[model samples]
Target: MTEADFLQLPDLAARSLGGAVVYANDEFFASRENLISPGAPDFDPSEFGHKGKVYDGWETRRRREPGHDFAVVRLGVPGVVEGVVIDTAWFTGNYPPYASVDGVNLEGYPTYQELLDAAWEPVLDRVALKGDAANAFVVDDDRPWTHLRLNIFPDGGVARFRVHGHARPDPAFLTGTIDLAALENGGDVVACSNRFYSSPRNIIGLGRSRHMGEGWENARRRDGGNDYVVIRLAGQGCVDHVEIDTSYFVGNAPGSARLSGIPNGDAMSDEPSWVELVPRTALLPDCRHRFRVDSPTPVEFVRLDVYPDGGIARLRVNGRLI
Candidate 1:
């Protein structure tokens, strides 16, 4: 899948990141929360409730009325919708035959009633869906969205609903210095040298690492080279300080790390000229190391290099936007 595809982009409605299924027309057989579950759907043939077979997805009662069923989801972060996935795994006989998606942008916290009253624009028109399979649809809209409404023709079960897109941080909220390398702020790990065990993207995710699994980890390097990940900042900024955390990785943390930055639109060529923001410094396992940057250059990208390659729970580049 390409970067623009919803399957490749981050889920903006992930419950783990403060997203919520605000309202659903009906959920007789399954809960609406299941639609944004991070894990894959599971099945047990014998598992059945009074309503019907218990599925790991959103399942409404069989349509008896004239209208369709719908669910409203508040995005974890406002972003531009690029793609969507209406997964119907394990929902063969009871999956929705067709679906459509709509989005809306609103500021501040809004009530469910307010969301229902808002004017929602179409992200995906009505389209046919396959049973027991991931139904992916590419969206072309670039408008930032804060909420989404998924409409299912003639109510049925849907294993999961994933909305993927690029984060568009509000400039008003970015008044003070902040972590320019944060995922919620729009920073992304565009490229990495290695991701054998875990994804480098995790390092920039929201909040501190809960465990080693939530951080970036790579295989032990046998050769004499280092490991690195390049991150595109949410916007150009003058980096002030940096933090490298190795929490929960007591035994396999990098010994040292270095940080570099470059302006946006510059070619990231082999051995590209990188301005050293933080010199090679020693790191401790299960601890947080903070350093002040001496450079004052405005940069749109940052690269973190770990000596000899090991796990790094998180990397924070604190700065003020330029």
Candidate 2:
């Protein structure tokens, strides 16, 4: 996939996604926790800390010695990394000249010292970086990794770090009824009619959206049709029930919606033959709507159609793996 497409993948390192900055060799100038903060990095020229000019990124004291600085991050969704964005926004003067990343697979809970002693394999070799830029790199590895180590050459600040990749949730925990379209469950919104205002992926986020911006939203549709999104399930399953939440979407909720499922796990996504899961139903603004699926056929993909669309806070495809 292209860099922009890779960006659509889940940020496995986002703090909101349950990731953590477990350890850092040094964060003398700034705290290490800022690395995986949600949203874009911000800057206030007048902001300053005691030791020196305050930075919004992880920073270490200028190296008088001969080693680089690094931080270990535990991924929220362990999976194969497709790419990374080392955002050095607002760190023009003190940004790192070079950086690299390493990955390792671990299970259960391991202490910081144990992670430090674990075997590390390179995910992205040393790459050149630009100050105040979002340096992107595509990793070609296919193995699922649970943790990552980001290394900055010598010493400098890096505003943010994003590990973009598909989620590979532990299959052992995916048994019985579950949200088949949840990002943490290995499902993804692969296609959509429009995502002008916000991403459709948010419709299946970790939990209920706190506001309208946290949900899937489309621009006002002028012509005839409507807006919709196609979600690929974690696996082939029989969808038993569904939840459509428009909470916090007071004025922009879709007037109505339809749900359908595709049994073709390997067939093309655009196949015309789709089994009806739920017929067109009226939806209330800022309310949670639930429906029972009468279909019995197993499906790997499902499509949700919103009539003359607006916003959808969350979608739950609770079902059993077949």
TM-score per candidate:
0.95, 0.97
TM-score quality measure for candidate 1? 0.95
lDDT of 2 by residue, 119-204 (tens): 99999999999999999998898999999999999889999999999899899999999999998899998889999999998898
**Model 2 backbone overlap count:** 0
Lowest summed-lDDT stretch of 10 residues in model 1? 1-10
The Cα RMSD of model 1 versus the native structure comes to 1.7
Give me the runs in candidate 2 sitting further than 4 Å from their true place. Answer: 266-270
* Model 1 Cα lDDT, one tens digit per residue, 1-322: 4534456567888875668898998999999989998879999999988888889999999887699999999998899988888999998888899999999999999999999999999989999999999888888888999999999998999998988888887888776799999878888888898999998988888888899999999999989999999999988899999899989888999989999998753627776667899888888989988899888778988989999899998999999988
Report the number of backbone clashes for model 1: 0
Candidate 1 regions off by >4 Å? 1-6
lDDT of 1 at 257: 90
